[model samples]
Target chain A: MLWACLRFPQLAFDALRGTLPNTPGAFAVVAGPAQRRGIVFANAAARGAGVRAGQAIATAQALCPHLCLLARDPAAEQQALGAFATLAWRYSSDIHLREPDAVLLEVGASLKLFDGWPALERRLRDEIARSGFACRIAAAPTACAAQVLTFAHDGIALTTTAVLQGALAQLPLAQGGLESATVTALHGMGLRTLGDLFRLPRAELARRTGPAALLHLDRLRGHLAEACPRWQPPARFARRLEFESAAHSTTALAFPLQRLLRELELFLLARDGGVQHFVLVLGHERGASTRVAVGLLAPQRDAAHLLELARVRLERIALPAPVYSLALQVDELPPLTPPHRDLFDTRAQGGLDWPALAERLRARLGDGALHGLACVADHRPTHAWRHTPLDPAAPATRDATAPAPTANRPFWLLPQPLVLRTAPQRILAGPERIESGWWDAHDQRRDYYVVELRGGQRAWAFTEAGSRQHWTLHGWFA
Target chain B: MFTSTADLFALDSLPASTAWPVAAPATTPASAPASVPAARNTAALDTVLRHPGIWRRRAPGTSALATQPSGHAALDALLPGGGWPRGALCELLVEHDGLGECSLLLPTLAALTQARRRVVLVAPPYVPYAPALAAAGVDLRHVVQIDAAHTDTHWTAEQCLRSGCCGAVLDWLPRSDYRELRRLQLAAESSGTLGFVFRPLAAADQASPCALRLRITTAMNGTQFELLKCRGRLGGATSLRLRA
Candidate 1:
């Protein structure tokens, strides 16, 4: 099987570049504790000024007076590697990530589908370049061999096993994936290349260099049946970004928050999914993370719409403290369903994008401000209906084919039935007795009638079960 | 070219394939074969217009104003468009806040709700009693009420109308000037949604940009629908009585 290896040699610096602001001067990634730190990666400008990896920070800065130093973050580097593996998974299902740097993908099954090696290689190079990473890519018969060859050349696609072995023989042992100690020991034994090492007796080499060296040689030559752990994408998505400076106000956070949302949009688009609920966590220096959970009436994946909803939600919140980092987590991702549009609309904008507008309004106005009315099966006026939250996913309980109310009903019912002293001028309809709602604690029995008052206003009035001949105004026809 | 008046009468005697009022192509009259077929097609079109089975042009005095049926035949006749004029303002001037105004608009609003069109109520004076509206065949799931600030009432109404997200917007703006009403009229026209502005009865004398103005008053027997102002028809002369 043919395997493709993508080696990102400077991931320590490249991973942090996306989160930081674009600066003019060069920067180098420093590793280890504060007291014993050294430069691990440098930009072109830093390298041109005589800065090299594994040198003390003080020595490197003395050599290049204008060099900037940034502390390396291992968590961000891991996340970036996972993102690269996810991108590579689009081309091949079988993928294994070599931590801190590279990805190995089995591309033998994908060659014909992607229109052969050259086209697939061009696409991979273009996409990786667009993602802001410098990669050294190589394809060989085995995963380990492909990775080892990637360090020797920028782009190499050797298909046959004979050509792969021939290319490996010429590559220097220093460039192969081996510990510095192993390479030094091999050089002490007068072995300069894989060709020199291959001619030695296997048992003698194993007795001298131990099992790790022999395993390495076996894996490189496709003789070892090693089990490489395949990478699986996590069901939930969580991304974090630490800002250069703390954002004290909502306006200041908008730019970085927008960038986080754009990344999430691309993530969901690649998965062919949509999120209905997500939480934005703002990490503050002194207090706990403040979480803003943004929900939608329907699942959405569009970045612009999600940003607009987040903007409205942000307007209503007061920042508890200055935030230095932001984490976006999406726990619920449902498959996206196509939006329903009116069939006969000829307008430039299709007939009423209602679901999107509803979500926007709900975000601006709290959930308490929006509700849907539902009818309950009760004879009493007040107990007959209830308000339900506006959720599009909830199945509708009110049947459209249900029978209508038999008695005459007014459009508006008074909140509290007012006691009346006098009778009306005329009675338009007869008394309708309603005696239900016995199961619930609040029960009522009354006779309702539609009448016109003396001052020429139509109203609905009811009299109690016991004889209090005085009429009570319950509602208006309006 | 049939410049002379007598030459027009000679078209009836010409061959059926020739067009009416033939042009005088004197120089190359015999060699023009293409014009013969083109003229014959015009003649065939004329024959189609004269056919008894076809309806040639609409009859005069038949109104063509687009309307949404008010669901009441007698009220539809009183309306200028034979129903409620859509995409225009309809002002309901009430003597009192509860003088059967909701009853008058319940039918139209219910139809819109059942059609899956959203009905928005902006700053309603009281909580919309759910049971009553549900009993009247109004789908409650499609109803949305906005309790906006007094300063934002007009702005909210205008936005809801302009958004095209609502099939009808019922705003209770008891006090508004000419400019505010005009903005709402334009918003309704642009979005093609019905905008109903409920105002006090005292505003009847003030001129409005609404297409239909109704003054509802309660009477001893029933309710009165007084057509105070209609866009293209005389007002105050036509009134209807309904048993509320």
Candidate 2:
């Protein structure tokens, strides 16, 4: 299999930097114990200021007094690797995540689908660059060899096993991805490159550096197939972004939220599905996180539309405390069936669809703000209709066969019946005796009448069965 | 030089079946046939009449404006195009709520919903009775009710109108100025969706950008309508007895 290995040489620095807004500054990532913390990665600005990796935190500060030293987070680095693997899944399904920094994809099958190796490579590079990662990619017949070549060369492509062997021979022992102890032992014996080690007697090499080193060499040469555990995408998508500083307002969180959303979009693309419900947890400095639940009427995956809905919801929320991080978790990604389009149907050609518009309204006005109307088979006016959630997938299953009511119903119903103080001028049409709802305990035994007030406004008034002197205005014909 | 209006009318010799010209005829050559200039003038007239914005009195029914019958014969007779104008905002200034305001447009809303087109009700003042709407032959499935706050009513209405997914958007704006109405009007025009804005009768004297505005007040038997503004013609106080 033709495997492509993507190595992020500065994953720790890039992962943390990506979470912050774009700004030019000397930054360095320091790791190890607090007492012996040293710079593990230094950005270009820091390197220019005479700061380099492996320097003590104190020394780096002395070199560049204004340097921004961030503690290296292994969790963030791991998350960045998973995100890259999700992106690579779009190119091929056979993905392998080499822990800490690299990912290998079996692109031999995908090359034809993407119209050959060069086009596929270009697309992969473009996606990597757009994701803001410094990646060194190399291809070989074996996964181990591809991973090793990434250390020796950035963009080397070895198609055949013979060419892969030749390339591996030129790679220095240090960059051959062997155990450091074995590399040191081999160096002590005057072996400068993998080619010198390969020429040694197999029994002698095994006796000197143990069998694990020999096995690694065999896997790299394709003599022994590497069984690296294939990476399987998690069932649910969850990504988090930590702010360099506490975000005092929702507006300050928009940029980082956008990045997480784009990553979620890529994740959805990899899964070939859409998300109907997701939650954004706004992490505060202490106590509980503010959770903003975003739900859609239908499955959606478009990043811009999702961001718009999220922004509207974000604007309405009052942050309890300054947000320090943001995490987006989307469970249950349903398969998306794109709306069918007819060539000649020009209605809402380029505008938002009905579901999307409804979602936006609901996002701003709260979930209960928008609803569909459904008529219930009840005699009581208040119980005659119910509010139903708008479900676009469901067909209009209106009960057309239901018998029409003999009496005319008013167009508008008041939430509560109002007691009328003045008497009506004349009676128009009702006084239909209605007695129902005994089963639900909301029994009503009233004679409803259509009456016209002094101003000629038609109103629906009702009186208790025994009392015609008192009338309650229940509805309006308008 | 063509001086009299009759002379300009006399030069209209192009066939009625001629297709609309794709582009305005370039500057006519000096030595062209004498009839060429007359044909160019006729072509220009055709272009003007074909514009969707323009209304022609002679062929009122033939104007390229979509309309839905208001279901009242007397009211339709008074309205331009013989019905409620589609793809344009229609304003109804009500003296109060229960003067057959909802009944006036119930027929058009029913027709839209029955035709499988969605009808959005944005921040309606009251809960529209479902049984009455169903009894009025409105498809309850296609009716969406959006209960937005007073501050967001105009924005919600504009979004619904501009989406083009809804066949009509009906909103009640008790406190809106002319600029807000104009924005809704433009959104409806662009998306070709029917928009209805209901306001208090106090704003009847204010200028509006709607295509039609009718002031309804309680009459002897039913509701009386005074046409304050209609896009194509000078509106008159045409009274019709709407059934209660």
For lDDT, the strongest prediction is 2
- Whole-model Cα lDDT of every candidate shown, in order: 0.79, 0.85
lDDT, candidate 2, at A39: 96
Q: Write the per-residue lDDT of candidate 2 for residues A2-112, one digit (tens) a residue.
A: 999999999989999866668899999999986899999999999998998899998999999999988888988988898889889899999998988999999999888
Question: For candidate 1, what is the DockQ-based docking class?
Answer: acceptable
iRMSD, all candidates:
2.7, 1.4
TM-score of every prediction relative to native: 0.81, 0.80
The model with the greatest DockQ is 2
Instruction: Name the weakest run of 10 consecutive residues (lDDT summed) in model 2 chain A.
Output: A398-407
Clashes by residue pair, model 2: none
Return the clash pairs for model 1, or none: B1-B24
Task: Report clashes for each candidate as comma-separated counts.
Answer: 1, 0
Q: Retained native contacts per candidate, as fractions?
A: 0.47, 0.85
How far residue A452's Cα lies from its native spot in candidate 2, in Å, is 3.4
